[model samples]
Target: MSNITRPWWKDAVVYQIYPASFHDSNNDGIGDIPGIIQKLDYIQSLGVEVIWVCPMYASPQIDMGYDISDYEAVHPPYGTVQDMEVLIKETHSRNMKVILDLVINHTSDQHAWFKESQSSKDNPKRDWYIWRPAKYDSEGKRGPPNNWRSFFGGSVWQWDEQTQEYYLHLFCTEQPDINWENEEARKAIYQSAMTSWLEKGVDGFRIDTVNMYSKPMDFPDAPVQDPSTPWQDASLIFCNGPNMDKYLDEMNAILSRYNAMSVGECPATPDRARVIRYVSAEAKKLNMVFQFDSVDVGQSKPSKYDTKPFNYTLADVKGAISRTQSLLDGTDAWTTSFIENHDQARSVSRFGNDSPTFRTRSGKMLSMLFASLSGTLFIYQGQEIGMINMPKDWDIAEYKDIDSQNFYADALARNPGNKAVKDFAKAGLQHLSRDHARTPMQWTAASPNAGFTGDKVKPWMRVNTSAQDGINVKDEDADATSVLNFWRSMLKVRKNHAEVLVHGTFQLVDENNEKVFSFVKTSLDGKDKALLVCNLSDEENRVPEFEGVELAEAMLLLDNPWEGRIYLID
Candidate 1:
């Protein structure tokens, strides 16, 4: 027998819930802890073993709860701390674990720590956050400390009139970067925020932008990517920083005490070996990390708001998947399998055709693609019913995400009086904005709000019109061949063949195929084997022949017109 010891998370399927859009129990136009509590039975029916709720902590909602002002308290809009405790208990009663979104990389400008840090240069909490003196130009004009651009837009450094100094904010100005280099600050974060939650019965955390905790102390200017713009993308300098490993080790030590699982949001780091280090079992840093190579395939630039789409092909996607499949072949490192999340646009709209004729077929095909991969599976809420992107005719005002709003404002300012530039930016946002994923969940066709809330009350975000066209859970759950049902069947197949589907060796077949993705998985003991062949396009494609496998003798396990075939070796 193999000597491998698998962690509980390895076999668990995670369901991510964006609380603001999941389900509103109080008819208050927002989804709260009680809302989630009401839907525990529905989630349990999906066969998911863990629930990863997005940030519902006390926040100003500048970044939609990412700008946390208080870690111990729940946002009043979401519910009370007592309500959260009941949620944890309810989820556990269903034999499911709970993992909250940990946004320790930064805190809201209104956070008490940031308020104290900005009070004065010599305050006791001044060192808790990064603050530097302003840089002066040749003309004596004061400017930000560095030329690094924020992920949301504008300069990464925001000038503080109170302290007469500039502070770093990798995201929006309201979210200030924490000083992980400070020993006292790190301990305080561990004890007050992390330890307190784990003690309250949370299983673990889904660390938001975990790789951005550390930064270069000297704060050097980023290399210019576009000379036309004043600021430059500083992802290279901010991600995988000098002290990333050390900080993760310190954080992981706390998690080990409770045997908690950690899946960090690690973006922009493409080096396979470097990515592996974050999840290496021997390092004991993180249990797994979410990588972005596969999702970044179609973007022309690092900025998701770029006006032009890249010349990416199906082969580019295949290459990314192939690389990730074999990334930790001989090591004990682990990775995550996901396509849809709160930060990304819907996968069916991006990867497959989302048109009227092919939406359901293509949605099932994409589900098969990810469920067959070897990693901890993560299914975002509403993805089960095949939600598509926002309507093409939506006005810019309908987009509520801060990132989308900032990009539109900057694009208009740069190209004044140019309607063509404005139209192009708007189209890009339609195809790539995070708001597409932030739309309220579609529960039924009974109302415009999709039954997420009462018919009289408006939801926090508009529900997609497609919900009225049989794309909601109530309709799909009743249809045996619906996309929602296909997901249930596919996940069951993965669980039934865990030996080959989860821990088996992955080998790509016909890597050059433009329309088909084929791979084989063999059990570790070499006793069982399976082959997965998927037709990524709408048209029919022939599967390429493998050198030694006999197709005639294989037993067909699962088959669908859009979804490819899975065969077991006899």
Candidate 2:
């Protein structure tokens, strides 16, 4: 193997903060940029090198912050533009980098550009967004241009009565897709919005739905293969389209000029070959890519919203992780090692035991697994303390995520008076609701707002009451054996052995063992090797004693059932 120079971000760990749920400053009931500023020390203490703040940009809050209205300005509830500047400066002062979540696939319908585009068919900005004439049947009945459906359900095309045309929106109707085919629109996005932020000194950006920017020139009607979700497999039409590489090359031209890094949030088929092309050094597109293989393990056929028995066995977990590690082992493209984020349920609750007896152990085990991987590690807010899913039995009224609400509505409307649909929808919510991850951060146990906001204001989202009892930061920080400390310790270990964990070669050990998921990582120099082992089950299990390896001389890293141990192999 040849020696390769690694980038600064390769050895860094990112902590994702859902801005709305992090911390509410000024008693506004909503978290703001200033609130993140207040918690800088706490974040730094966790040993993360990059803070990825989920979009705090101006929006109508349709799909949370993903529906970007004003890219250059901060949302009013999230503080002023000045607050964002302060956040950047404060993060830098702490010797850490800041990654802003950039949503460029679409823009809020309320954006000035979109508003003007819809004013008239011949408006100068009319071509800024995707527009097509409504197709008519033999009876002259008006309908959508194609059978493409929105990710949020219903038709992707929205009819504009005033303009007498239909605009494409892959997400909510309020989020109109930008016309990437339009050279002017592409220039505006790259020059105006992205460049403005790069100049603001942000380290990099996490591009949301990066692959969905380009669309095929010929709009084709999607075949209805699954009635549950006709649009689930329709990603090939929009994701990684013909002009995707061209647009990314242009984006890289701008990003490389600033010497910045880019992590593309691409949800493509779990094909390593397809993903590596996006972030390969030769590709010059992105610094890393977040794949959905691990997160989409138990997703049923056709639709992710459809409820499936959560009987995902240990083999399924190992297959997803090992396959990714094996494929990207010697490649230039870097993988993002993450268990949970703003879009998924809490990791402990999803993959491990969230019960009081094993919450800490399971959380620590999952953390150790990702930390020892051969790429950048991401820790979502509250993940450090092993935050579990939202409280059980919570009603739909308590959920605020647009995706969940839309899924429920579609399920109900599709099968009115059908108890099966209602039961399935509720079951899906219990296990897969985005709200499970969007709940307010539990900072302290005491108070009406869990110390996330002042006593008078109710937080935008409900705080997990379970967190207050035993999982809050205040409680975890004081306990030496807490999951919080384990995370800090694991992060410190990764930093201490950057060459091995960040750029090392990954090899799975005891591949067929259903009770233990273990691997050995060798440093680039091949001088230092670390063997990490974990007990995947709740019951006690023994780590297989390898034929050529000896443990008597090994240094035990973690001594627990969930987090087994990491030894310095001779």
Candidate 3:
């Protein structure tokens, strides 16, 4: 028998909450900490063990709170510091853990550190952020230091005339990348941001872009991805940099002292071995990291905005899942099972059918497929009720996400007066915009705001019209066979068979089946086994035959016709 003890997070189910759109208590048009406190009971009813709330930190909202201006303070629109404390206490009182989004890769340009750093070249805080002198062209015109493109759009460097220098920003210009290479800055981050929250009784964190802390010391130009644009994709050069593991080790050391769990958002890292090093128990870094293979299925190289038509098949989806499922095999590392989050579009729309005819069935199928996977499970807000992408009729002006807006603007500027280019860009936004995930959560069919806020007040984002078609929580909660109810049942099933479902070893059974995703899970002790067969298409699919396994002896444990069928093997 093994003496190793499993962490609480290993078998846990995490429900991700995008605070801005989750629920609004004060009818203030925005969701807040107090609103979350009021919904704790509802969240607990989902059988989730943890709540990973997106950043509610003090910010200018340039990147929707990813650009933190004050590490210790709460965003006034979200709530006061006192409200955050109550939220933590209330969550703990329910015997559930709460993890906040940790976005330390960059800080709002308005951050006191960055403000001081930008004041003058000789400022004591000048080294807190990455700053470089402007490069001169042949004609002596000053430009950014490198040709690296920002994740949102244009150049990664933003010029500040006050200091006559350009500051690095991997994302939007308003968010400046921190100099993690600076020891003093790192120490300050550990003490002021992470340690402060842990001491405040917060459980853990869902670290954003955790692998992006370090960068090459000498700035280098990225290879051009598009001949039309001057800037190039820099993700390959910046992500998982030289000091990434070293910085993670330091962060992990602090988290260890508090016995806290960490799930890092690691993008542009496709190497399974590299991800293992980040999450391996022996490495003492992150507990698990969110991989992007499944989400980046049809996206064009370098940019999600430059997407291909939705031509990806079930095999593509299964292949991504198989790779992620096997990532930690024979190792102490763990993985996170998720298909939807704050940054990604709804899973029902992206992976499963979300039309009026098949939404509920497909949603339940996806729920069962992910809930029974061999790792920690995560369900995004509104996903349990089969929420989908934004309405196709919504105008481009209705899209509020900076990433989507910037891409659309840039696309238009590149091909002015080209109707085809404009239409293509609009289609891409409709399919993949982050705003689709940011829409207000649908609680009921009430007009104006779908009960997310008072009908008299407008929500920060438009509520999906699907709420009127029996997709809201209130309608689904009452329907015994609704997707919401199925999720509840599926979660119970996962908990009841935790050993075989959560900690089991996974093996892909029907490797080449285009429409069927069939897999087997065997417990570590080799005593219990379960077979899960899912039909990834709208049409019915026959379960594949397994060698030496008798279908006659298999007992059906759970079944959803769309289909997610699990059988206990004798």
Candidate 4:
């Protein structure tokens, strides 16, 4: 790689492309490799330098492409390995780097390795997965080996009649945990999984649940929260275990050998000190770690954050992001800033004006905030069009994400019954469904299906009905002042002022601006400066705090001033 292209990652902007919904290559009503090729120009026009393709691997898609059956092949639905090579080559030709989603924590139970691992106790690969004998009561009633809960809403175990033992699965039962403690398993995963892809000249990885590679030796009973619930396992016990660094070191050594870039989707947010230490420059584990404090904005007591209802005023969002930036200061703790991805609700629906009134400004507010932060920003598919959370009126069957569906069913299973299950159903659709984001990209306003794929054939997931009027990408692109343009302008500003935005110290300007989330980013010399103020409120509101700064040439850098504006203060 040329020096210019080699270090380009440090300055590159990563646009996350969800392949299944990015574009339809064969008009098969699903996005594919050829479609990604067709859309490269569009991505380049937006000035993106990296394309983070989120899993195009062969799998049962038990966790929507998170489970891997074949580490080195492409799913037939997406295309051939040749197609991926073409995509990578085309991306490189356009000066854009390519990154793949590295899911090493677990693999499809159908994977040959897992199949062999579960064959019998005497199998050579028997210890290649987290397997244990089922627990039995005095009466000989059998249950999971431990009281762990699967994230998909069940006990984290599946009984195997062949071996008369249960295997653990943190996600769907079809996806079992890989025993990283097994040297053969680790070497197989590293060589066949990371090394092969890295050798293809692709950039690094986004390690899915990276910290879950390690586990607790004793599969203990979980503490009770909602007691009537059948099971619970505090993820902390197994995730980010005592062996975290050892595992990361090994993973990093391979990635480093290939000079690849890496980031860890670490859900383990112990504290600022812990986060800093884990992501610190000397760690040699990853380039960055995605702290979900922003995404998981669910309500929590200071001591615990798992109960949900992450209600946040604009002030809360500002505070959380501001604090995260502060912790990463003076350190090499790179961050992955984003609004929507495979997890969480869409930003438009959750924060901005998905409700019709505040959509444009609110969407603009979130974009400006995340883009301005000092980190490698990841703009999820359709976020450029300001896609919102799923709507309440949609039928329950429209859902495809197993987790949210499981959550809804589990919420309904309580004996005395869940309070406001209907409200939660409404909120879950509006605030947490991954299906809200997997819908096809609305590329053209005039065509049916908004030219995403086509109404002629059904999309795997139901397209958001709102795409008809408000969310078409073509319409927004033509309208220079559209929410899409706000994204364009924000990218432009970041590129123009890269030094101040990417390396400057980030400080929250006003904590009490309920409507305006303000921050000032300053260069080392303090000569370079930029002020970001976003209006997250529904109605018109001026930034009461930034009103003090006197200006000489306050050019309007960008504005969604339906009640928010970004003035280039002089």
Candidate 5:
């Protein structure tokens, strides 16, 4: 048997739940913690070891829960902290672990701390946030501390009339970047807030934008990526700044004392050396990080979402993941694998099959590639059911995601009459949009809303139009060869073959195939290896090249294709 003493994460798969979109118990059209409690069995039945719930803290909902109004209190709409305790207890009742999302780099302007800090220049908490005086131009017009722009829109600074100074906000003007250099702020962050949750028994944390805490002491303008565009300039300064690892080390020290799993949303690292420095297990910084390279499958550049659609092939997808995994191998470092999350469009639409014939097959194919790799696996809600992208024609008024809404508003304000703006929104559908994956879970094929929320109850967003005709968990559960079955079987194989599938050496096998992505996984303990191959395209694949690796004694583990053989290599 696989070592039971190892942490659940060592070889486990996790499922991410966006609380607002997960499930609703009161039929109030909003999903809350009590509703999450109702769905715990459904989550556990998937064999998931960890359930990572996004922020449920007190928030103004401007940027979802990323803008925190109160660090200690749970959002009233989600549930009270007492409800959270019950959910955590329910998660632990089974063998499953529960992880919480931590967003500590900034706080909502509505937060008591920020409210007090912005009260006056002489307030005891005035220095708790990054605030600076306005720089004067030759024309005597006041400018911000620097030319930095907010990730959401125009300027990173909002003037506080009482202080006559501009405060820094990397995201929204509402979320001012906290001064981590302040000892009291650090105390409240790591000691009072973080430990309170840990002491209450949360298993781990998935830190949002973990590298954004530290910044250059002297705030200055960042060299622009696209000089013509200001959006590109905003991300340059904050992500993975100079003092990033210092902040990480300090955070790690606090988390490590309790032996909790720490996964960071890290980006902007130049190379593998930087990745290693941030995530090395011995360094006690981070256990894992979600690299954007694999997720940027269809993008030409890292952050420019509107530029253009680059042609993407299966080999390119395989290549990106292979390179990332290879570079982080054997370094006591690892990465995260997810196809759909709150931040991106759905995987089924972007990479897999949206049609009838290809839907289940492609979902299984992608699941195999991610689960067989040497890292943690994350399954966004509705992914196993093969949920595709949202309707491309969705109007800007339909989106609730702050980033998407801000972009839409910015485009309209810049060029209201421009048809290019229309085309831009359509193309933007292909890049980043939360609507693609935030649809309600499709529980049954019979119900109107797929049995997610009640019929009269208005869901936060509409369910994918395809749920009736294409995707539903009930149908897949009954269909033996469905994507749902494939997902469960894949998890079974991963669990049963933990040594070979989890702690194994990963090698990319086929580089020339345009449509087929194949890799070999060999156990670190020198056990027999397995070939995990998938033809991501629609055409039938017949591989006769690697003939010596025949499996005479091998039985088929899971055949995703309905008509395909369980035992192949014929």
Candidate 6:
């Protein structure tokens, strides 16, 4: 619902690439920028208008590339700054825009700024990061200044022995949160990093952890949701701080100069009122925001890594989308709708059945569901080929993700010697592990490394074993009935009816139908109208007749048993 007169991003379809697992051109087992350059043709073929590559910034890989050690340079494994320049130029040549992941919430402890800040309390750059002295308890035991906890678990404050103080890190200990309250630090980030990238012809950014930049003036203890797990919900104190608008407005001042297409990761901003304030065109804060309401449908409370299982129903899915669309209907705030991303499990495995008997059919149904939505569509890497979760038999050691590894260990510590603890940990992995989506992209079944690397080289992460059996880009590309081709057709449908799907008014038609997610899109002027119907369940469903509309020959998007159809109603 942006008030901007020109919203060029509305028609854009974004494809997210996890650079490490995408393609490894050097055969070193890790995917790099050069490998991305090699796959430009393949990316362009998917009909995506924008490519949002996850962080490739220089880092120690403590949290993959999110712990940026250098803002201006690319990571060694990814490539050089010169390679990035070439990538921007090449992407532009293909008429596709490129947006890099911006991780300004924190910097690696190895970063020069953090290093200087942690050197001594009286250092010139000491104020650049959040620092505090230890608070001793009544019994004289020293502890962190506050009760805040890290999103990855444990205390948020990492003690700096040299400085005799602690630095804040909402994530890993290696990533220290920067102090946005420091005007000098803010100016330095803008001048040295953001503007520098814009000058290099980069489109915009997917700002990482956007809402956590502004911390409360008094670092307060969050309301303890569970006394046993005191750190389960510290977001109440740290997230969406008072100065978030002020900071974002400063960012918009720089972004507006280039007319950038900026989207922020705002998991902390759930309400429509707060979200609109950031994304409203008149406010000019950001073009769009990624929210967690829809994705958090079946997500367990307290923490996503909690022992509880995901049991979201079909009605929950319908309600999530319907409520979101209703809130943003007439406003300038827009929805950045998506099913899967780097930090999420594969949508096919989560929402739809990934079993061999229903995999392809459910994939097509999901694709249809995504295409019918009235917002920008984002497709994650390997999503087009119906890539699923890791093999069921794979052991925990095979998982390389830091977040997953940490959670498993923490769960075990909580329930010592209990067999149910392992079961609980395994269940979380099966349902919500971020590593599920980080597996190496499957290119071809014939290659030893799934054509993601050289024949003799083992991939940095294991490839989906099913890639060798049939689920691969090469096979799907050749087969007309494959998931890849179905995605192509769905994209084509969205493009052909852009007026309805992209810019029209969304209305849920069959709200009470528990087995079907059905909605109608009407042109702004009401001349054009299209109704989308999808069978959310496995059983065959008959379309319920409408009162005023005549049902002509329906454009069957997906065949019987997996019912999906579009009709032009007069």
Per-model TM values vs. the true structure: 0.98, 0.96, 0.98, 0.93, 0.94, 0.96
Query: How well is each residue in 498-528 modelled by candidate 5, as lDDT tens digits?
Result: 7767776777766788867777777766655
Q: Candidate 2 residues 359-419, lDDT tens each? A: 8899888888888888888889999989888777787788788888888888889899999
Please give, for residues 115-210, the per-residue lDDT of candidate 1 as tens digits: 999999999999999999988999999998889999988898998888899999999999999999999989988987799999999999999999
lDDT of each: 0.88, 0.84, 0.89, 0.77, 0.76, 0.84
Candidate 3 residue-wise lDDT at 201: 86
Clashing residue pairs in candidate 1 are none
Best-fitting candidate, scored by lDDT:
3
The candidate 5 region of ten consecutive residues with least summed lDDT is 561-570
What number of backbone clashes does candidate 2 have, counting pairs of residues 3 or more apart or in separate chains? 0
Which parts of model 5 are misplaced by more than 4 Å?
1-5, 230-236, 300-304, 307-310, 551-555, 562-570
Q: Write the residue-wise lDDT of candidate 6 on 1-570 in tens digits.
A: 224354778888999999999999899999999999999999999889999999998999988899999999899988999999998999999999999888998999999998899888888899999999899989998888888878888889988878788888999999999999999999999986799999999888999988999988688788777788746567866888999999999999998899788889988665779888888878888888887777887777556867455477778888888765654578977777788999988888888778888888778888887876777788999999999988778988877888888888888889888888888787888778889899999999966789999989888898788898678999999999888998888888788777777777888776788788888888766887788888877787877665577666544433424567777554
Which residue runs of candidate 3 sit more than 4 Å off their true CA positions?
1-4
Clash number for candidate 1? 0
Error of 3 at 487 (Å): 0.7
What residue pairs are clashing in model 5? Answer: none
Candidate 4 lDDT tens digits, 388-418: 7656777778777777676666556652365
TM-score-better candidate, 3 vs 5: 3
Residue-level lDDT of model 3, residues 280-318, one tens digit each, is 989998999999888887776556857645758877887
**Number of backbone-clashing residue pairs for each candidate, in the order shown:** 0, 0, 0, 8, 0, 7
Clashing pairs in 6: 1-331, 1-332, 1-333, 1-334, 2-281, 2-332, 3-281
> By TM-score, is 5 or 6 better?
6
Q: Alpha-carbon error at 455 in model 6, in Å?
A: 2.1
